[model samples]
Target: MRTHESGRLVQAALAAITAAAAFGVTACGSDDSASSSSSAEKPAATSTPAAESGKITADSANKGKSIKLGSKNFTESIIIADIYGQALQKAGFTVKYDLNLGLEDVANKAVEDGDIDGYPEYTGTALTALLGVDPSDVPKDEDAAYQEAKKLYKSKFGFTALPQTPFTDSNSLGMTKQKAAELGNPKTISDLKGKSQNLTIAASAECFKRTDCALGFRKVYGLKFKKEIKIDVAQRHEVILKKKADLTVPFTTDGAIAANKEVILKDDKQLFPPYNVTFVLSQKAADKLGPAGQKVIETVQKGLTTPVMSELNSRVDLDKEKPEDVAAEYLKDYL
Candidate 1:
């Protein structure tokens, strides 16, 4: 659990002032009079307060309030949590980060137990994982999935589900370009029919049981791979890169796909349900945020299209940048 105070802007302002004072002292001691004069004439640097500089404005109603935000333990979730947390901080709400809270069930419990005020959650995950809805029963349409999840959350947990992002990060089968070429460049999962018999597939342990993954491949596509390897979710791409597996289960918006390190086959049969993200908050927390705070979250998320999110994920997964740093940079456009 990590807590970020709203004092960051205050610290930046102090630093700017200190730098300006040092510049002034240096100008007074300069041997070059003309250079000193030029320096003296130049305006001192200023630090703009986030609320003033950013599209998200501080609301008087949100002052003195704090929101605890959490995320599932994944690159995309961490980055998204940071983005929402930082944006709320700018809007006069003291934002606390309780990130890397493990999987959907863990995050759901955290919010329910008040360990976190809210967190980002995928629509399909809410239905299939938390709500106990079968994968086969999950809605295929993105909006329909979000609405069902939203309705269920409200009735079951008194949670408020915010509008979802444009991107849907559903489960997908991915392979290297070379591997795809060897398989005759199959464009869809159905195309892999007989070829799967010779392929070694890899995925997280749970995926093997889930209807949206290994089970789906066998039941929906009639695929029977030569071997099924249980790997860590984070290592799905690595196994493919190392040629240990011919195919791996990955999220549609995985950074590896964005980097072209792996290519996702189209899910023509739509085995996986829509997994668009939305902020789920406790009713009390939602009331605390009010309309202004809600607007701030919605506004910041507006720019998170699939490609944009993939690139942000790539910055963390491929470029080795910190999630918080990537989020801060992303918020710059809104700011």
Candidate 2:
């Protein structure tokens, strides 16, 4: 009873309706009903959608959504958190910060308790500290470690770990250039084996207990220091510079290393696990962020290679720039 033109018109109308329904389903879902598996499996997009036009612009879908971002009590963590927060803000999400949230356990609890929607975390820390995986059992391969941590996070806590950043900030033995030269320029931790007996090493008390720290130096590299001084992580570079300690445990990406103030002794035996950065978000928050928001988070991190991150840290630690300001400057290109 219908003409050919009428049938085509009906089909078009139905297609429009179907498209609208699909979008509506995505926009309105119960907080708990969202599945993290899809988001987790989706590879991070290499390009920023909002920046395609040469400037970041707000998405209508993200305008009303809010995300609470948190970070551990460290300069690098805070800088990373600020980067994520500012990028989300540009995408029209109301980002609330809960920075300096203490240690890994405290930050984990904050995310679990909904005190924060998410935070940037190291894959090694998440595997060992949060998931109870032994550090030795943690995968040495970066992608493999990230996947294991992501799967465990979802199963154990119903959280989602977004794509990892390009950089990996693992613990390493560092000493001043002068001290290294004095030690005959030991190029690797193994080179310190026989010489360690005369060197005074310093690190946080926890480092003495971790297999990846003083324990690893002793076991894996057969290095035993003359004296192990318990010092805070903040004083790592200072201790070496002040000559209080001949060597100190520092993160590979420490600003001091970037500034050439300290030399990282290579882990020839690979004692430390990969500590790549991943943003851990609640299932509910991940669902609300959806694919577009997740892409924004991933895109901004694409530029954060080890050297780039080290420089960013140097800006804050050496240049004394605020993390927020440093983040803003870094995001300018994306904006």
The collision pairs in model 1 are none
Top lDDT hit? 1
Clashes of 2: 0
For all candidates in order, the CA lDDT equals 0.75, 0.75
TM-score of each: 0.81, 0.81
Q: What's model 2's lDDT at 301?
A: 74
lDDT of 1 by residue, 240-288 (tens): 9899999999888876775665778999988889989999999999999
Task: Check candidate 2 and list the clashing pairs.
Answer: none
CA deviation > 4 Å runs, candidate 1: 1-54
- TM-score (C-alpha) between model 1 and the true structure: 0.81
Taking all chains together, the TM-score of candidate 2 against the true structure is 0.81
